[model samples]
Target: MSLVVTATGTEVGKTVVSALLLARYRQASYWKPVASGACEGSDSETVQRLAPEGTRILEEGYSFDPPVSPHLAARWAGESIEVERLVPKGRESGLVIEGIGGVMVPLRDDGVLFLDLLVQWGQPCLLVASSQLGTLNHTLLSLAALRAQRVPVAGVVLNGPPNRDNREAIERFGEVEVIAELPVLDPLNRSTVTQAASGFDTAGQLAGLLDQSQGECR
Candidate 1:
């Protein structure tokens, strides 16, 4: 079973949230299906470094050398990212599947969006959001997009300075849980992830979803 981790937008700490889940969930593995910055660094590399020791990393569906949008990066590589291959088969180990960019990021020129990919996977998602100014709008809009696509969002994780007012506004208007408020760590390392993960309550929220998804296979 896999639990998808998406963001309100790019650089919203989606990978960090996935690392936190991998650290907290003993049975969890990590996978980022499509990577654009393979030359610079891959999210899978960060997860392997931050996840608990000996964690399993599933290879990506596709990788491009440039740090760009999947559509552009794939084009630069003289290929296209097939929408169907992005959804991996269900696995025995629990998985934290990291999504690319935001919900509406185009996976290819033909107009397959990440939100569409989420719908195809039919997996409950954890939205990673920023806590800086203007987050309320982005977070709320993100929730709306997910709802419009009929993707079950498990909750949200605010990954920036702690702002009670904004957090409350999101919860009040969006009607979704904020599972954790991760402070900006000076140095992001395993210790920081472990200490910060105590603030997260997403594993329990996702437990039932993963159990049911895996149970259907059995």
Candidate 2:
């Protein structure tokens, strides 16, 4: 009953959405298997700061200093990313996995992609997308790629200013629900994240998809 958080591209609010999911499912543990930009700060650390107190943030599988493509970053660090080792070990339930960059991002020089890893993990994905102008194309393309690989998608989470037209278009064309639309937060702290999470999954649609028991979030 775990979910993978992926996005149309890098910095498109995947980490924020991960925090929101963790807030909604307080018992859920967060794991970012492959992190490329460890030099700045890992998403796991940010989630730990933003998620509810006592939330479990698991250690990453592969961490490289360079903020580049995972393949390139691993190469620069004198290592190679093996997709097999990236899979979660003991945490099979109530885990939220955050992906690096977009769905089609490469994990190695042999052309293995983040999408491939998702397929291997066999968990549904929560696609995070921007609510901006170019999101239609990016979101649709990401969805298409996931569908092409037969990966099950839990739903889409739009991050940024709310746009009705974009949301409608994504649902109509992409044929998936816009589970939640997250507004841009100024301070982006724990209190604000908790407030935002209160509105998310209010109807328990995401909970149903994740097979979580009713009323799990406190």
Candidate 3:
């Protein structure tokens, strides 16, 4: 089954972790629907640059000029983001979909949320969180939000310097596994991605999330 990568908030190294996962799982595909930024490039572009060669990256679902929330961005652009059309026609093994912002961000005014897409996909997700002190609250809250919506979690990936205490706290109280603790990269590059990938096995970490048989069509 396809996997999704979401975060507690923006700029939490979610894309970096996605890159590392793609680097480790060479056959994996990456998709980031409803992207808001376009100056530096989309999140899919960042993944394409950092992921291992031959990674199948899909086009963004909807792109906005301003780097703002999907709802605002789409409103400013005079376009409606449709959730029904956003779901992948089929699932593929190692298909890693990335969501914009946090799980609660809205895509449109009809109460469609990023979490709604995750619930529709009905697959487990890898929640990326900061390893800093404030992460405990944010992490647990995000976990609760996902569970409240009936979303299955693949696990958590704390993105920052190793914070054993924070990790333990999340694992103990959050009731979700800490898949890996990714340290900050010195000079973020392909090499850095490969190095970070060593922290977790590609398939081992995702086995629980991938429920459907590989390469199965819908």
Candidate 4:
């Protein structure tokens, strides 16, 4: 089964979560459909660097140098990211796709949202949400959108400091399990990420969820 990691907004540690998830499985392909703000050496480069050995790169297209929303970035680059060209390819490799922006960000003039691409890929999603205040709305809204699109969500992985009330409410009320909670570190800092990569505990958490979901499917 494939898994896509997404957030309510940008800068919510999606790449970090993607790397951790990639470390979990063998031969998992990592694909970022559209990326913006490509420096010579940046987070996208870091993602390629930190991916485990034998990992297959399915598809990646970096648009341009604007650190803005994908729609604006694509427009700035004078070319749009076509949805037709963005689907997964090759054999039945398990995937971990990371989105460029938030869930509702537009990809084309015809109103193709990012979530549309996720639905096309047809994978159980692992939402990476912030654990700070206001996360409840962000998490629930994202879940609502996913449900509206009929996407099967595996569970949510809160990607910042853990909040007891937030987690409980999302579980009890939202009815979606909180699979894992990862703490936030210094902004753009790779130290905690390096440690997490070396330790690789998120793999167990993700694997546990995948096993549970698969059994349910059977």
Candidate 5:
């Protein structure tokens, strides 16, 4: 089974949660379709570094240093970000694809949305929403959009500071399962990711979310 990891917006802990999920599985393939604002030393590089063992890094079509939306970033680079160009690794050991920006971000001027690719690939999405204030709206809106488009949503994972009230509201109001709650990490270092990985009850909470026996496909 392939899982698409996306957030309400950029830097909402999508990569961090992705890393943690990867670690929970111990082994999987990762893909970042359209990365933007990646300088010489950037979070994308850090993500690549934090990937668990045996995680094959899939090729990305667009990597921009502008740290902005892919459309504008690609425009600056005299190109365009098109999700159709991304080569699918074909459900090998469960692919985890991370989107470049938020849901509505345009990949090309032709009005192609990033979510379209996730739908085309037919991977159940794992929504990663920040635990900060105003997350309820973001989370709900994202859920509504996905539902409207007939996209398969696996579940939601709340990241960053743990707000018990907000978390409870999301589960009740959004009507989606909360797969995990990742607290804010001090220094926000890679070790925190490792610690989270070690503690995840993968075989329990997340097991049902994962495709256990893609036997012949794998």
Candidate 6:
């Protein structure tokens, strides 16, 4: 069972969390299904660089050069994103799949969304969110949306400065565990990523979840 890593919005540390997961779960590989910012750089590349040696970084299902919404980027590139083709190939277990943009972002012109794709994939999700002001609303709303679609949430990962109040609020209202709280590394590198990962899933909670059959959040 592959774990899906997504965020409330872009630049909210999905890649960093993905790297942390890959580092923590040595057997897991990394995959970003649809990459819209190929011109700038690839998240797969960043994950590959940050993840420990021998981490398998799989090829993306769709790659567009424009750094914009996936639907628009596909249009700009004179193409369209087929949701079915985004499925992970070959390896099913021990894979970490990262999503593009936010959960509600459009994936096609016909109004399909990233959330829709997540529902289609039917895998457990680890939502990455900020640990700052306004997270209460964003995190709660995202959790609501995911639950509404019956997407099994593995847990939440808060990335940024530590905020105990926010973490408590999310865990209380959202009814999910704060699996990990990743602080901003002074110098973000493989060493720091490894250090951060060492502190994550220390009790094998996430690994245990992946080992079992998927279940909905209460």
| TM-score for each predicted model, relative to the true structure | 0.92, 0.96, 0.92, 0.82, 0.88, 0.94
Q: Which stretches in model 4 have alpha-carbon errors above 4 Å?
A: 40-43, 90-92, 185-218
Name the best candidate (by lDDT).
2
Deviation in Å, model 1, residue 166 alpha carbon: 0.7
Instruction: Please report, as a residue range, the 10-residue window in candidate 6 with the lowest summed lDDT.
Output: 209-218
Q: Which residue pairs come into collision in candidate 6?
A: none
Candidates' C-alpha lDDT: 0.83, 0.89, 0.82, 0.71, 0.75, 0.87
Candidate 2 per-residue lDDT over residues 174-202, each given as its tens digit: 99999999999989999999989889978
lDDT of 3 by residue, 35-118 (tens): 888765778888878988778888888888788889998888888898888976365556788878998999897878999999
Q: TM-score of model 6 relative to the true fold?
A: 0.94
For candidate 1, lDDT tens digit of each residue in 112-165?
Answer: 888889999898899999998988889998899999989999888898889998
Model 5, 103-186: lDDT tens digits are 777887778888787678777888899988989999999988888888888788888777898888989998888778888877
Distance from true position, residue 121, model 5, in Å? 1.4
After superposition on all CA atoms, what RMSD does each candidate show versus the true structure?
3.6, 1.2, 3.6, 4.4, 3.4, 3.9
In the range 37-145, model 4's lDDT, one tens digit per residue, is: 7643445566666656555665476556777777788887788878878866545456677887688888876788898888887777888888889998998999999
Candidate 6 residue-wise lDDT at 45: 90
Among residues 3 or more apart in sequence or in different chains, the pairs in candidate 2 whose N, CA or C atoms overlap within 3 Å are none
Candidate 1 colliding pairs? none
Better of 2 and 5 by TM-score: 2
Candidate 5: segments with Cα more than 4 A from true spot: 40-43, 201-218
